[model samples]
Target chain A: MPCPYLEYRDTSADQSFDEARAFCTVVEEFVQPMRADICNDRYALDHESHCEIYRAHAEGEE
Target chain B: MSYEAFLDGDPVIVTAALTGGVHGKEANPNVPETPEEIGRAAGEVEAAGASVVHLHARRPNGERSFDTERFQEIDDAVRRHTDDVVIQHSTGGTGAPDADRHRPLRTDPPPEMASLDMGPLNRYDHLTSENTRGLVDSLHAEMVDRGIKPELEVFNDGHRNEVHGLLARRDLADPVYATLIFGPGTLTRPRPEHFLTAIADLPDGATFNTLGFGRHQLPFATMGILFGGHVRVGLEDNVYYERGELAESNAQLVERVVRVAEELGRPVATTDEAREILGL
Candidate 1:
C-alpha cells in the first residue's frame, strides 16, 4: 500500500510507502546531515529514525 | 513493525493488560495482586498469544502503589517467567503523589514501555485525571533519554493532538504508539464512526490500539482488528467475559481475543514480534 502520509500530502490517494520515502528525500534537505550528526551517539541515526521529525511536521500541516 | 508493515496486513499485536491501577479480587478472585500471581498470569497470557504485559504495582495490602521497589519486584518476577513478554510498567495510576507518578520513569532499571496519559480528564465519582503539560513534557523527555517507549493513553482528540505536539518538539521516539481508551464518560463514544474519525487523521508513523472500560472491552478488541489496528485486553479492562459472567483469569480474556482474531484471519503477533513492532 502507498504511504498514507505521502498520499495525504500529495493528495495522490495511492496510500503508498514509496511516496512517503520520496517525500523523505525532499525532507533530507534539512534533516540529512543535521539529523545524522544528531543521531551519531548512542542512537543508530536517532534523528533520522523513521524520518519521524519531518513526517510529523509535514503531516501536521495536512 | 512500522506502520507501513502493520498497515500492510501484518499480524495484530495483542497486549495483555494484566493488572491496572484499579480493581482487585473482589471484582474477580483471579485478578493477580501479588508478584507471584502476576508472574503466573504473565506466563499464561504469553503462552496464549500475548506479546506484551501492561502492569501496575500494588502495595502488600492490595492498594495501588507507585513505589519503585514494588515495581522492581513485579518486573523481576515477570521477567523470571519469560523475557520475551514485553513488560510495560505504568506511571499513570490514580491517587499517587508526583514522586510516585515519576517512579517508573526514574527507576533504576526501566521497563520496555510505560503507560503515559496525554493529559488530564474528569471521570467517575471524586476522581480527576490530571496530567499537566509541564509534567507530560518532562515525562516525554525522560522516556526518550532512558530508552523506554511511551504507550500514550489517548482519552480524547485533545490527547491525540498533544502527541503530535510532542513529536513536533521531538520529545518522543519514532513509531510512536497510542492506546485509545473508550469508557463511561469518555470524550468519544464506543462507536465505529467515533473511533474511525478519532484516528483517521493520525500523522504518519503514529499507530494506536483500542480498549474499553467494562462492557466495551470485547467490542473494542473486535473493532481494532476490523480497523487494522492493534488490541489491548485483560482483567484490567474487564473482569467479566460476558454479561454476569466473571472471568477466571486474565488468560480467559486473552484467549477469547485470540480465538476471535483467528476466526477473522488476523494472525497474532508473537512476543518478539511485538517488541519489534513497538520499536522496543
Candidate 2:
C-alpha cells in the first residue's frame, strides 16, 4: 500500500504509479515516485516505512 | 568549441553525475547508494540523453569510498547496464589521505576520465579539502600515465588561475577540458558576470563544462547551453526537479536539460560525438 500522505500528480504517459511524480501531504512538497518493486514488496510493513518523510511525520504523531 | 559555435549550432555534451561523495539517501531517497542502484541510474540517465556518467563510489554503509575495488564494482555494474556512456570517476574528497585519492584511478580498465581538483576549498562549516599542488600534480601524472583525461575542477578563481600554471607545467592532451563550479563556500559565486569572466579567463582552445550547486543548476546549465559550453547535472549536484520537488531520478534531470538544449537549437551530443569532441 502507498503512503497515506502520498498523492500522485503529473502522471506519466503510461499512467504508471511508479513513474508518476507525487506530492507528500506531510512535507507539503512533491517528490519522485518510489520504484514499483520497492512500493510493491509484499513483505514490507507499509509505504510509510519506505519513506523517510512519512516515517518522520508518523513518529511525530506518535 | 567556442561561443562562436553557438551561432553555428554545435552539439552540447551532457554529463550526469550519478552520485556524489557529500550527500546521500537522507537528502533524497532517490539518490542511488549501492553499485547496483548506481548502475541502474546510469542506464536511465544515458537513455535520457547524458553521454557521460560521473560516478562516486560509496561504502556498503553509504559513506564515500575511494577504494579501487569499490570503484571497479561500480564500473562493472555501469558497463553491464549502459551501452556506451562514458565513465568518469571523482577523485576529489575532503580530508582523505592523498595516496588514497589515487586509488580511484587504478581500476583495471581505468576510467576514460577523472576529476582533478585544481586547488583547495572549504566544504561545510569546519572541513577543508587541502588539494595541494603536490597532490594535484601527482594525480595528473597518474591520470596521464593511465591514459585518462583529466577534468580540471575549478572551485574558485584561484583554482581557475592555477589551471594556467598546470597547463604550463604539464603536457595535457588537446582541447583542455575544465569544469567551472559555482556556488557558496569556496566556489566562485554563482553569478552571470562571474561565469562570463571565468570563461573569458580560460586557456585559449580549452573546453568548459558548467556546474552550479542546487538551485543554480538550471540557470547555469541554460547559460552553458547558450554559451556553447557543455553541462553537468544530476542528483549529485541538485536533488530537486524544482523548488520543493525532489528529483525523481538522474534521468529526470538529464531529460530536462536535453529538452532545453533541443528547444534552443543545440542538438544534444551522442556518446560518440562526446568522445570525439573530448578527443577520447
Best model number under TM-score? 2
Query: Per-residue error at B87 for model 2, in Å?
Result: 0.5
Cα lDDT of model 2 by residue, B1-280, tens digit: 5668677789999999988877666568788878999999999999999999999988664556778999999999999999999999999876577888999999989999999999988743434678999999999999999999999999999987799999989899988999999988889999999999999999989999999999999999999999989999999999999999999999999999999999998999999999999999
DockQ of 2: 0.03
Q: Predicted chain A of model 1: TM-score relative to the true chain A? A: 0.23
Candidate 1 chain B weakest ten by summed lDDT: B1-10
Residue pairs with backbone overlap in model 2: none
Report the lDDT of model 2 for residue B167.
91
CAPRI tier for the interface of model 1: incorrect
lDDT of 1 by residue, B1-280 (tens): 2334334667888999997756665456677888888988999999899898999887553446677888888888888886578889888844345556788766567887988888887644334557877777777777778889999888877888887776777646667798888877745577767787776756677777878778899887888877778899999889898899988888989999999887777789987777777888
Q: Which parts of model 2 have CA positions greater than 4 angstroms off?
A: A1-62
A22-49 in candidate 1: lDDT tens per residue? Answer: 2323333211111222223212223223
| Docking category of candidate 2 | incorrect
DockQ of 1: 0.01
